[model samples]
Target chain A: MTPLVVGTSAIKRATTPELVFAVVRDALIAHAHDRTTVPPPLHLQFPDADGDCHVKAGWVTDTPGFAVKIATGFYRNPAAGLPTNHGLVCAVSARTGEINAILDDQGLLTAWRTAAAGALATHAMARPGAATLAVFGTGEQARLQVEWLARLRPIDTVLVHGRSKDKTRSLCEAFDALGHHARPALADEAAAADMIITTTPAPTPVLQARHVRAGAHVTGIGTDMPHKNELPPALFARAALIATDDHRQCLDHGDFGHAVRAGVTTDTSDTPVGLLLERPVERPDGAITVADLTGVGALDAALAAAVLRELAS
Target chain B: MTPLVVGTSAIKRATTPELVFAVVRDALIAHAHDRTTVPPPLHLQFPDADGDCHVKAGWVTDTPGFAVKIATGFYRNPAAGLPTNHGLVCAVSARTGEINAILDDQGLLTAWRTAAAGALATHAMARPGAATLAVFGTGEQARLQVEWLARLRPIDTVLVHGRSKDKTRSLCEAFDALGHHARPALADEAAAADMIITTTPAPTPVLQARHVRAGAHVTGIGTDMPHKNELPPALFARAALIATDDHRQCLDHGDFGHAVRAGVTTDTSDTPVGLLLERPVERPDGAITVADLTGVGALDAALAAAVLRELAS
Candidate 1:
């Protein structure tokens, strides 16, 4: 049998970001429901003059279509001015174990899957009239957040805040072309927005506790590694709900890790985003809601599997 | 940069079984001399239907230009007519993390490596002018053992024993074509040969203590799993020197496992094959010698790395 060869360009042309977002959302939900135990991924840390570590995470599910992999290369910082996070997603045939696709769009799948996590969280926790959206970080993920959030909520205005004003303004203009009232805003403007999405890799807190409004939903997908932080621990102290993709990973690397270390949140009962994504749960009325997404291997596998199915069909 | 792709046909055409056997022999010698803390390989078992299981063993080493994988799949006899043992060797590039070559030659690599282990043991343990050879099993590994033994030692006669007379005759013909005096013989004929090699996947002992010649050298490579046995425990009691690729693996799975269980051998201080292969060691003169080779992932990785280097040049 001929091996499947799907590239990033083909994946982009075949499916829209919105459709991929939706498929990824559903896949994450299905995986959340699956109770099968998977082996912990093998971790490989390379020994070099400069400390550059690569974590190879693998998950094989008995899904009928394919065996999907979400391999992310995290080079803390290379001397060559390359992005710290850059890698590819591979989908392989289950029967023959042939790699069918290489979606090397430089973390495009990562951004989409992360954005889907936010959408899934919104579907489970956010209020019905979440019209005002605030996104921190004017990079590719910031653009993806706007595209994916618009699919789940009827947003009339989006507040864009970044370290660079010119980049944020350009992002706002792109959002404006999508028929939304998007504008560069101060940090206070983010607090007033109904839903706040942070995608910056700031080493320090970018979102303050005092700026956030009551009943505001906050989704942080930036602080995936231990050293990165976008939200302060005090922010989750009064939040009604704090959810995360994987509680263990969050406690080790996400904003929840800082919160747990600071003695703000101790229990892990409702922290797992998978549990919240699968069912409609009651969010504390008029209380701040937070969802910390560190990303998971299963989510990547799911999205790759979904993309493969759509392309084959 | 374009990725390197070396398929089974390329490997078959570029390197002969004899050359591969010699390459492995030299690798074993090099590895024995290299001082490094080598750990036993990790095994992953998959539970299947009918109370059977599939095993996957992984070996990783930090040796330069050596990061290959040896994955074997074994299944119990079922209604399907698939071979009980089959798998592939994936040779990966250390610099780029790309799989450079795949050898799917019906486990030919395994047979060649095993034969090389036997040859290494013969060089270390056999006395001068030891010529007569006896092989148990008419499989691919049996053929490899005959050819490799002929290349290493001055062997003019070879006795072949197997359950199938037709297969034994055919294998004898192939060996005879290689300019050796070869013929089909009974299991008792092996007793007269100066050197013996066992390659069958028999669940019970195929070579008893009485069938081995005095002062002869024996190498068994088939009983790598706990449930498989090719040589009786009595043989272990008689051998003055017995070595293995990995002492821990042999104690857990190879012929040593059964011997230890039956109280035939109490100590394993001198069992690691590396000690014998690296330097001249003290052993009883004209005593029976044995080497158990369950295969090692580091060796596979090293051989794959060598092959990749050769291909690149």
Candidate 2:
């Protein structure tokens, strides 16, 4: 069997942002429904290293793509010229453990998986025909959120807030190319959108609690590590319902961790993304909803499985 | 840029048991001197499965060859006809994570690495010029043990013990063909040899305290998982000194776990194999010595690195 080399360039060539978003969304839903088998993340700590490495290898056998994936990332000091998060996802044959495809997109899989988590959360929490959206950050993850959210809802306008004017302009241009009504906005304009998506690596809080409007849904995806934060801890106090991709991981490394550390309520019975995806739950009509998408290995396994099946067929 | 495919048949064709022994032994010595970078083992556990699957991937950079190895195995229910242990070792590029070779020798890399571990322990613990040897099991590991032990010591005679007489006789024939005195013997006769190697997957104790003589060095490589045991727990009390590949793993899953659970000792400080390899520790002249060879990911990484360097040159 010839091994398929699905590098970052190949993914860029073969898949559009919209197609990737749709596949990833379906993959997340499939995984959350227990239609996939994703092994626990394997943790590795290099000798004398400041942080740890997380490895998740799994096979999504029932997802039409009998493929196995091995994803590895390093959570270490960024001063080492290595991104604090970088890894490759290898899709393999579930029948033979033969590596079939290698996706060299260092953090692309994480971005897509995070967006899938958002879409999954929105399906459970958002009101029908919810349109206006606000995204903080003009980076890869921010771009992914726009594409993925666009697929799930009919967003007539998008407010993009970024630290850099040039990046915000480029993001606006990209969104325009996608035929969305997008414009650069001040950070406070995030209150005008029905939904807010924050994807930044800032150590300090980028979104304040006062800027969030009532009944607005917020999805935070960047604070997946202990040293990073995207949303203020105060925001959790106002959230009527808080859902997360993986409660255990979120409790340890997500925005929820910061909230819990800051003396916020630790009641997590209803926060698991799996629970929201598996069962029909009531979403209060005018209450603030927040979904912490710290990214889960299961979603990556699910999407890789889907892509492998597609490529195989 | 071509991935090397070293299947079971190919490994059997490309390497003789003798050559594999030598390669593994040299790798162990080279690795002991801090000459390799060994990655931690990667694990995968299917949902609802009783046990986990492990993958050990590594690169031996300084050896004459350039190869990366991925060895896969499982600890699962034995009724599945799956051998409970199945794996392939893929040797890939040192510069790139490209596959160079795939060897499906039923975890031959395990056999080689285990033999190397035994060889390394013998080199560090056995009395200089030790000759007579006794090896348990007539399987591939047993064959490799004999070959590796012979390289460390000039063995004029080797006593073989196994459950089946016909299988032992077949092993004896293979050994005798190599011009050594190899013969099937009763388990008690194993005590007469200066060096004893046990490589069977026996659930209960195969070697007892009374059977091992003074100054004899024992290396047990079979009992790796927590449920497995090859050496009697009482034997650990009698040994003057004990060492292991990785002390924590050994304390958790190896013969040492059994010993510790049985209240053999309160302290395990002197048990790390790295201690024995790094320093010239004092061993009582006529005291019994024991070395537990539960495998470690570091050794796989070490060997893979060496093999890769060798292939490159």
Candidate 3:
């Protein structure tokens, strides 16, 4: 069968915040309930080009189609006036294995799915009435996490932290334009916020356990690669609860893996974020919660299937 | 940059047997010389649909672009008036990780490459002037094997062996149209031919060692998956020289693996087909040679790149 070639414009028109969040949430729950099949992702590194590509495929039992997504990141692309990321998702019929649609979303779907996952994990684990937020990156994810989470909870303040002063200031201004009281802050200052999300690709810890305030929730969006770490190992030891989008993936390359390898927490200590989303975990007074997300393919599949359905309608 | 979306017709227009053979040969040699980077392929099985999809990506050091190919086989599709296989290849700039072209060949390139590899292996390992050819399946590969091999060598007799009488007859007719003496043959009769190429996805051996004649060469092409075995394990034991494309992959999932697992051959007994292509292994009088091809990603990448270049020009 000839597949419908849906371009970025059509995909953007079909995508809604509600749709992304709902699909991502259901995908995570399905994964946690063991109803999804996600094979280990294929990662290709182009060190000479300062780029990497990830090929992820997933099948949810309830979805009509499976998605195989190719997402690439060229760290130096911005300097060449190109986007740092590019990708397309191929949706195939689960019954016939015939590709039905090529969603050339150009990495937008991945970004949206990631943001929704981070927001869901943060909202599910963070204490209620958490208003202040800290975002430790000046990239698309940092802005996305803060904005998407604001859809779930009230964010009265946003603390932006990054090594680049210019980019950090620009991100803070972007958040300010979104009507949140935003300003640049040091790592320690940002870590003290009520909700913290680390989105930097720092090879070393960006925040220490001692700097985070009590009753704070920290969601890690970076550290998807083995060489990346954004949270200190001691941070896991100080947490009241730890959660992960994918247990195996997060334990292999996520910050939780680093903490586990450092003996900060046992491998089995972290709970699946989907479980917490289904049945909210009790948050004690003055407790800290951490969520590690290394990304999951099931969310991509569900979101792609949902978007294709939306486009078809 | 906008990627060129070349459909099946365009792909077909650009593809030629000579181009396929040249690119595939270079890819094999590059792989043998460690001049290509091929990550482990991603395989997903959908038993409910009687389908499986394989995602393979590779980059040759000398190539300007890389390719990620998705090939799916739905064995039951033919009953629904659909082809049993479907696939596409995405070619990306290796220097930038930006997808530059999508060759929607719909599995044609894969079939051609497979056919080319089989013929190359058959010609490389078979005794000089070996003309009698026995193909153990009447599928596309079966026809292509006989035809492509005819391009490399003079085949005086073509033996088609398949379960379906009609298919076997049809294949023989096709070979007759191509001006070759073709007829149906049983296991023992076919195995006694100068060269044998097995193309059936049989879970058990299609031919036994005792049936194969001395000095005959066999190229097994269908035992790519772990559970599939096209050649008898004892067949490897009787062979004087064994060759394989991608030693690691062949040793893990190819017919070579079956032989090793069954204690018929040691793991180190098989030589890389690429090495044999570069320096032909001496064949003793009345000695048998066997080749196991599991399919390599580098060939896909190289072939895709060549096709894209052809389309552009």
Candidate 4:
């Protein structure tokens, strides 16, 4: 039989958040053991045209093939009421170089994989029995992060912080509909939560080091570009340990880039979250942990493989 | 209005050799002028599986678009009467980052583009009114070189030289059907022709430098890998000028690579074929010229845009 060429609808029906989260966790762990080949990501930037397209690819050795994802961000599309972000994924055979399937994921797979990464980070770093969670953005990622993290930990209250009050309230309303308690909170109050996730596209730091309390597990899921940052540079110094999905990628771009540039931390010795997952480390009591995820190719490859398997079954 | 998802049939129906040649030439020119951003090429090598997939992408400023080509080579498929090479092209809007078309060309576009590239080189470096061309291979590329170059130059006689007599005879029959004179000849006899084209995947020098006469314009198109070679190292010393689609790429992984390693040439300042095309050079009679093409991404980008335009019309 020919490889399936599926659309967004098929992918949505084929995968659930829990399955994707597990797949993503395994993929990231594979990165640490050197069981996967993830090439340095590349992109075509159309600065004059107000857009950029990032291309990432990777392959995992065990029961996993390969995948190539092309994700685009058109900063001006929202002005026309069109989608600002979208892309496709191609799953290929590691044995024959045959493209086994092309999932016109339309960026759905990317979103899910990203949220899953956040969940993995939160699970590995957050304090056990922590009841309060805070999200720094009110977008889809913020909502998904809250939902995914809730499943991974025992959470009772959710605090939301955004530049706009109405948008933040809407995010809270989403949690309320899902039978969870959520409310808009001030930036300082949100930073004080036991687990905080920053998913905003802010170009400057929104979370201050002074407000972040002890034993806080903070994950920065936004700031994919060099100019975009969410966490204050000083926060890295305040955290007990800084972890990242792909340390090299984060150091070159995203929040770590700013941190490095600001001389806040010249630490290239940060740990990969994969290593932390492979060998579970009980967090030193009352220690603050920071995770920076700028998205890597392995997670996409794993998610695509999982989705293809789902459709096959 | 929806982005066209086409296969080889549509690509064939929508493009003529001349149109594609023009498109490719324009693209190369755009590359020379630095009007196109051609990212470094990437590949996936499944050594255990005896397969490799090369991925290339670029964007031309004038077209305001981007293109990505995924070309795969599966070495063992020929035993099953299956084509060992296949790939696809995607043309996209740079302004909006929207995928405008998906050309499932099945490697047809790549073959045509390669042949067109040969034509462009021949037209640029071959002596005016050159005839009696010798092609050193019996594969599809060797055959297509004859057809595409015949239109670019005044060729009436073609000398075929391959180790396999049966394959060479069949190649001769192809030219015979086109109302041209083609006959099998010795390596020396072929080298003495006015123009020589080596499209064979020979791992060692096939054309001895002593056999290549003066005033012959030679092109080695088969040796894109470091381990492959078709032209003798000493041949470079005899040529008045060495031109390539991309000088940097050729030096890294083509005939130029072997020649450089052999100490036959330390010349890194070779002119680009586009420069020669832009300013048609009047070659002095009896001057030997060489052109190396290692497949650049700009040509793929331009070809995708051209195909999309044809479909739109």
Say which docking band candidate 4 falls in: acceptable
What DockQ do you compute for every candidate structure? 0.11, 0.20, 0.69, 0.47
Error of 4 at B123 (Å): 1.5
Q: Model 4 off-target regions past 4 Å?
A: A1-4, A62-64, A185-189, A257-268, B1-3, B161-165, B183-193, B200-211, B223-239, B257-268
Scored by DockQ, the top model is 3
Give one digit per residue, the lDDT tens place, for model 2 in B1-313.
2234444554444554455555554444554455545454555544344444565543333432232234333334345555545545544333322344544446666777787678768767887767778888887889888887676667788899999999999999988987789999888898657888888878998777788888888888888667679888787888888887656667776787788788875446336665676556577888888888777665565444444444455
Query: Relative to the true structure, how large is the alpha-carbon lDDT of every model?
Result: 0.67, 0.66, 0.90, 0.83
Looking at model 4, the pairs that clash are none
| Model 1: residues with Cα > 4 Å off, grouped in runs | A1-4, A13-30, A33-37, A49-62, A65-150, A154-273, A285-311, B16-139, B154-276, B285-301
Q: Which digits, one per residue and each the tens of the lDDT, describe model 3 over residues A137-223?
A: 999999999999999988999999999999999998899999999999998899999999999899999988999998999999999
Q: Order the candidates by lDDT, highest first.
A: 3, 4, 1, 2
RMSD of each: 6.5, 5.3, 1.6, 3.0
State each candidate's clash count. Answer: 1, 20, 0, 0
Residue B300 local lDDT, model 1: 68
Report the lDDT tens digits of candidate 2 across residue range A62-171. 43223233333334434545555544565544433445555555556656667666765765676665688889899887887788777776778889999999999999
lDDT of 1 by residue, A155-231 (tens): 88999999898999899999999999999888887867889988887888887888898878888888877888888
Docking quality tier of candidate 2? incorrect
Model 3: CA > 4 A from native: none
Candidate 3 local lDDT, B16-94, one digit each (tens): 9999999988898899888888888898888888988889998888578889998889999999999888878999888
Question: Which candidate has the top score in TM-score?
Answer: 3
